[model samples]
Target: MASANVVDNSDHSRFDLLVDDKPAGLVAYSRRGDNIELVHTEVDPAYEGHGYGSLLARSALDAARAEGLRVWPLCPFIQSFLKQHPEYLDLVPQTQVTRFKLA
Candidate 1:
């Protein structure tokens, strides 16, 4: 069965975006005591602008939601993704929004 939860590739400290079972991109993060700091997100140049980055963003956020962790999106890409998708605004604590410029 296809799992609802995204895989956490801890060895690499990132979530993999797979295409045909191969990684097309990754969303990297660092752990912070029940919170996650999104550090970098990248898709292969061949996969750029193909919504793969969005897939990585959504998967990372959804995983954070499922794990009851808050988010600190430091990466510009992730920050922009959150801006485009306000539904995830709540994942970041209200007080820290301006600090991250996510407000």
Candidate 2:
């Protein structure tokens, strides 16, 4: 896998993704207890097919993982990504696992 050049902007808090000096996409989250609610995510139309959204989600997920926080991905893309990529399964809240259809 080719390493993605994902930058953690804004002091490890709000996360945004820029590709080649342009705003390619972004992911927003709010911390709730030991879980972070993944609020939103979007990829520029031009950047949609290049997996930029996934890059943002992965970076945010990585941050949550480091903090020992379970994730509640309300963003549809991140929710779908969670389903597709099972390796990150441990990062999801066990109670919501059924809602996310991870079982």
- For lDDT, the strongest prediction is 1
Instruction: Name the regions of candidate 1 deviating beyond 4 angstroms.
Output: 1-6
Please report how far candidate 2 places residue 35 from its true position, in Å.
1.8
Q: Can you give the lDDT of residue 78 in candidate 1?
A: 92
RMSD of each: 3.3, 2.9
Off by over 4 Å in 2: 1-4, 9-13
Candidate-wise lDDT, in order: 0.83, 0.78
Provide the lDDT at 65 for model 2: 91
Evaluate residue 42 in candidate 1 and report its C-alpha lDDT on the 0 to 100 scale: 83
For candidate 2, report its TM-score. 0.83
Lowest lDDT sum, 10 consecutive residues, model 1, at 1-10
Candidate 1 lDDT over 44-91, as tens digits, reads 886676677888899999999989999988899999988899899999
The global Cα lDDT (0 to 1) of model 2 is 0.78
